[model samples]
Target: MPHRLHLEQFGPVHALPVLHYRLEFAHLVREAVRRVKPDCIAIELPSTIEAPFLRAVERLPEISVIHYEGRQRRDGAESVYLLVEPADPLVEGARLALERRIPLRLVDVDTDSYPRHVEALPDSYAIHRIGLTPYYEEYRRAAASVAPGREDRRRERGMAWRLQELAKEHGSILFVCGMYHLERIKDDFGRPQAAPLERVRRQGVRLFNLHPDSCREILDEFPFISAVHELRRGPLPPEPDDRGETLRKRFSAFELIVGGRKDLPAEELLRHAVERGARHAGRGEEFPDRQRIIFRLFQEAARHYRQETGDPVHLWQKRAFFRFARNYALASGALLPDLFQLLMAARGCVDDNFAYALWRLATFYHWQRAEADIPTISISPEEIWGGSRRIRFRPRERRRKGLSHLGFLKRKKEKRPGEWLEGFTDPSICSYPPEDVLIEEYGRFLKKKGAMQLSEELSRTEPFTSSLLDGIDLRETLRNVADGRVYVRESQRAKGGVGSVVVIFDEDRENGNYPYRTTWLGEHEQESDMAFYATPPEDNIVGPGICRCEYGGFLLSYPPRRMMDVWRDPDYVFARSKPEVLLLAALDYSPEKHVVHVAARPPRSIFRQIAARMGKKIVHIPLGSLSSVKLKSIRVLHILHGHDKRQVAKDYIW
Candidate 1:
């Protein structure tokens, strides 16, 4: 993170205008001059992009190019957009020189040498050779990456030489290049200049890095110019409410988080974050709507609190007694709090825990149904409604923000609700329970808020109790089972089959009794509660974690974990049980040898071997279990990749 006082947006210095999505390198070069005030600015752009740079420094102007060459394409259309042709970075740096009346310079390969750095020539490296000096090995590798055609690249390697040569020339010369290649680079010819930098010290050349802030600004100013910059767009997007500015400022935080993976540059991490946010949104149907609503509530509350207290402090009294606020003058990247942040931020609003609960529920939906294509919705000003003097609840029927599994599922449909709900009148009925209960009853809450759109088909039809219609309407019926009048029972005729919902009592018990309150087991459990409780035969057994079933697929624990073997073996099964998580402990042998037990069935052992060999490739078990027939015990998350000595040997290579 740059010092808060030292942030800037880029545009060409003295360029005719300022336009959104127009400026590029010129803006960056110009900003560097002001914020860094570095004696020298070294850039990392390719030598080929250097010529036009000279023109800008020389104060020469040219026409803009309308076409973009090779930006990424989606749906076969151009993804990179350029509002105005950018004055290359070289030209921008040079122009800055004239304005500041300082020396401007370019650092690149000396075209005369086929490859600028000796290190670049792997076979010809001095360090790897017999008794070659470390200096030669270092220089050899560094020079190899420079463009084989540029000559000035020598400036980096010949730093001592350049210093002595430029002793006659006074003042600092800044070198401008792209940020990506900066770290991988070394002084030209792989020279070790740090010692020389301390002992000899150069007069004309001074090196300073153009950081993430400036980098993001330059990239933010225009459309796609490189794959690297594009990656910074993450899970959440910039909002446009009062909270929007603060949210944007949060985006500036990089060093505090994943700074260890330098290989996964800041830009890449940002892009991943944005995608994750989008994925979270699109993962569920209720998320986009719920996130948007809460964000609106936050924005409204934040703005109002700021006005009352004359400070922009966070007030999360509930989750933690924590509150944070930037100087009112500072810029924020987001208009609303993130889902996590909002959990705490809600304390500033109502005393009730509903806001926090709603947010958590949405989080659970994402974690549980991670397999679903849910979309994440950024809580933007447009999505918010309550901020107005006359507050309203506008349930957007449209798809939500960052794409998630649910968002994907909803978007894939052609339905026309949740896009935007503008005109809703208060319904006279109050028989339906609260929004929380609805979501608890049904898989997800209807779109957003307690209000659910009763589809013409499902709502008016009379409830059916016939076994023939049960399978087709399982999930839907499970939803309606919340009504106390409905009771799901097993058919008396079949041993392993299910029946339908039948009224056990003539009168209603309580306002409503959700039948599906307990988690459903499986296909068998849906039809018959007995199927849910049927225990594995004592002689044979049931194991935990993933076990290649005697039959085809895999099995998992129906409810939460309540096992003894899971305690003994930690690796047998994954216990958290994420979406479609297979709890194998249920099938693993607890009392008998699985091999002997299944010896009655040969294919099962074969299947287990195949599954073990393949691991995740063969099957995915969110909850795992292992059964030891000889030990007569079942273990969940108890097994490692059952030994592949050859693969393990290869994997352990240091």
Candidate 2:
């Protein structure tokens, strides 16, 4: 594929020992140069490719030479990295030009002085993305609600423009760049703007490239799917007709699934459902949908609602749906060969919502598949891979009683009969404990001890809520944001696992909402941040000022009754280390705690007494072994594995 000018080959380059293959490539290049014996020998690649190009190009320096390269990221971090990598391609090409004593021309985009923007200083040509942020957000979404494939077409014309720009400045002997990019380079936006080869010929400038057979090894090796892209894709296609009443029927099916009653129209219902979703988030609460709610969304957007179940009501769902869908399609291409093929067949058959859903499912299949690590064929040869699916959805079941329990409660509220709103109609209207109302009415309630406010002696807490503090100190500020009562300073940062609930539903595992993801609390959000992360109220054993942290599922906190105070009032141990008993007592039920293990080397009687105060016991054994400790009602068996670790395995008992 070399240009028709006298061809030359340069050989025996690189640090590798003069092996047969190494010498062969050098010999090939040397011969290509010898035939061309014209003024200058121009090689390809940037200056940093290797020293061989420098040596060869210099050998025939009667001709001028040049090197070429591309650009990468533009931020400060990437700048330092570029210094080491030298991302240019004209090294060997320029070295040959210099060695042949020929003239040289170097060409490429430069972002040395300014930050790289999508459309700024594009070396590949004038073509580029108009905006940056939207492009960045494209990959964040799991679905391809937007056109996810236009990036490849954009890269092509940009390169052509850059080359032409370079050609205008230099003489008839300008070499564009690497063969791969040059091959795909289009003179215009692929809309039949004259071909690159035609233009290069008009200028009387020759072009060169590599053959397909020569580069087959590399083409066969790498996978071409876009992973973690920073691209701005074009807009999405218009939605097609859903085939007679098929779309209507499918929408109805989803409506029936989420809402027990199927009478309501889909669009209006979706708005109101979103309103409910908003209300939950406004209070910083996770929206736990009733089964009725679930069935409604499923009926409307069956595939979509399934994934939206666990994500926050924020923009994450909409964004993730597209990204996940695209990735799934790419990874599942081999498994679901008909994916894009089927997509292309029907052409405009899918809507943004359902299309995003399908695409999201296909994308996430990588981790979801049992054998993600195993590569398989994505598109099959036999698959015609076109035409749209008329996936009519039908609800598996429906709830018979929608708020039947609230019927009498609405009657008791004494509203005009026709205007009555039942309990299920709205949950926020339901009554709170007397203390909440009292606090709202009388401020923080205090026992009027000797006509003095003793409210400071007690406090209340809500899950993930902090107590009200005025002119706060360290104790109240950190709260559940971190662990313990370690003194903190101004501008201190504390972050912990934020979203924790045992709510059961769909989309929990897939979206990373469950198991867990770390949400943050910086030194900002002030008192409210602490209040929301650690809402402390009165009457909890999490005693005085602030106490134990109710983080995630368990409490890593001290006994509410202070060690000093509880020591004076030993009966208080029931509220401190024994919250299990304390909670049962709150519910008027009694549970037992067993001192299951007696240490093999029993502690001193005085130590035993102190440990016993915290619900432990000590016992003696002759040998170092601890098989002697037996128990009843103990679920966690902690056997001593050695020092500092435990062999915690389930101990089955008869």
Candidate 3:
């Protein structure tokens, strides 16, 4: 059996040693304080920096770090940092003490003489399985292997001495210190040895809020863990019911950001995630590490991906993604990958959109408003409402006086001034890769809709007491077991192939509105030949010469031929408007007898007559019949005319 540490056993001075990296430890500390109600609280920070540190703690949700620069033993400079997030045990302890009107003492050795060495600690989550004392024992073995030096011993003795003095005044005093120093402090509990103290001049000391981007580096837990800790106001409990509530609350915040129905509860999703995480971790005597919650989040992301793309994440893909994430975690020097690492892995293994969903779900909790009075940093205009502020610890570099005029002039100049044409490039020569991916995705959507539209008239009836036979409807037969009757109905296999499609987004003859027309040869033979007439790219530039334009009309010829040049074809000159030209070209190039036309209405009589002369037919499908949002997305296509633009196209493409 594993041994658990008991705080009450230690009498007036109950030493609760903690490993800082695990958020669970912080919660444990908070629980101890609540149970013991110590008269005075002693934290493991130096007395010299209590004011600024406490001030930063008082400002809770606005995460801040203590930055101090002190003289080195050899005479140079050494920097020390301590991040104070709401989940931090020391910060929480201090806050609790302050809230309860208990005296909070900073009792560790001064920062200048504090041991600067770092040792890799065991995973804090292990405490859930092996119990606290056993985990601490393991940690002690790991730290002793590294061996403490004179400075380490001095710091321990000094903290011990401080605790001894505090116990004399307060009936019950609690001391929260590093796990490695705990055993040593107990050994020197009653000794009357002179404690070492180094009183160096206080160097540069400033308090700066922690930047969101740097949270992964300085914080002990995943941002999601930190977020949940903030919401629950403690570490996650081992009980299934409590865990479910916490998980649901976290995902509920995520759902709101992703535009889920405001009234719909996220409990079902959270329940599914927890069950799956437990399964994945394998059942044993110990509970799985809390990191398993990440798997649940990815599952949620996968569901979202299916909803958006109509595809499910394959089993192999999920395995590969976790493997890749683990490799990244190892590279990041962490026992498990956090959201940042997971996002990076997702981008490479999946796509940006999938990774983007994961990021949104993980970060949603950070933006949620605290229901009670909690410490939070002031929001900035750029941070968005309910969003954490972006800050940096590093000082901003001062610009030289000589270059100040240029900055002043740059600020004075209007951005994207119509008068300034120097930076503007030809739209036909530049490309936006993302726009290309969007167009491709929209094309796939169109193909699916066209197939469905071709079979729109056909209806399926099963469990045949009613209609003619098509096939044995096994699904209906299984569903109606009470009747035990077989049903069948009329069915037609989808046949009308959409060899070519012409889309006239602007049904009206507004030819003058679309000033630019461009033709693009497909990069590969499998792609379609395309010609489009839309707004001039130069006037609506997104990047350099890359411009976004609405599609007045377009022609798509599949199994593209090198001779397919619809824009310059004199055969289409007879057509009056861009839509007419595109319709004519689509009818002419379609290999199939019928062509799909997506427009406000059927083509003009002349175009129909031309199609009839060529022994071809047109299938008219209203533009509104298809998803408007999807069509609108594809209506805007980017054109790249030069090699310079095409060379870098892959970067912008998904």
Candidate 2 C-alpha lDDT tens digits along 450-513: 0121123233233323432333354554665565433322232122111111111112223322
Name model 1 segments beyond 4 Å from true.
1-28, 35-53, 56-91, 110-168, 179-472, 477-654
Clashes of each: 123, 114, 11
lDDT of 1 by residue, 532-640 (tens): 1111111111111111111111222322233333323465444332111122332342121111111111222444553354331112111101111211111101111
Rank the candidate models, highest TM-score first: 3, 1, 2
Query: With candidate 3 superimposed using the best TM-score fit, by how many Å does residue 563's alpha carbon deviate from the native?
Result: 25
TM-scores of the candidates are 0.23, 0.18, 0.49
lDDT (0-100) at residue 87 of candidate 2?
A: 12
Residue 109, candidate 3: C-alpha displacement in angstroms: 1.0
| Angstrom error at residue 65, model 1 | 7.3
Q: How accurate is candidate 3 locally (lDDT)?
A: 0.62
Flag regions of model 3 displaced more than 4 Å: 1-11, 72-76, 113-115, 195-204, 211-218, 234-289, 296-316, 326-335, 356-654
lDDT of each: 0.27, 0.25, 0.62
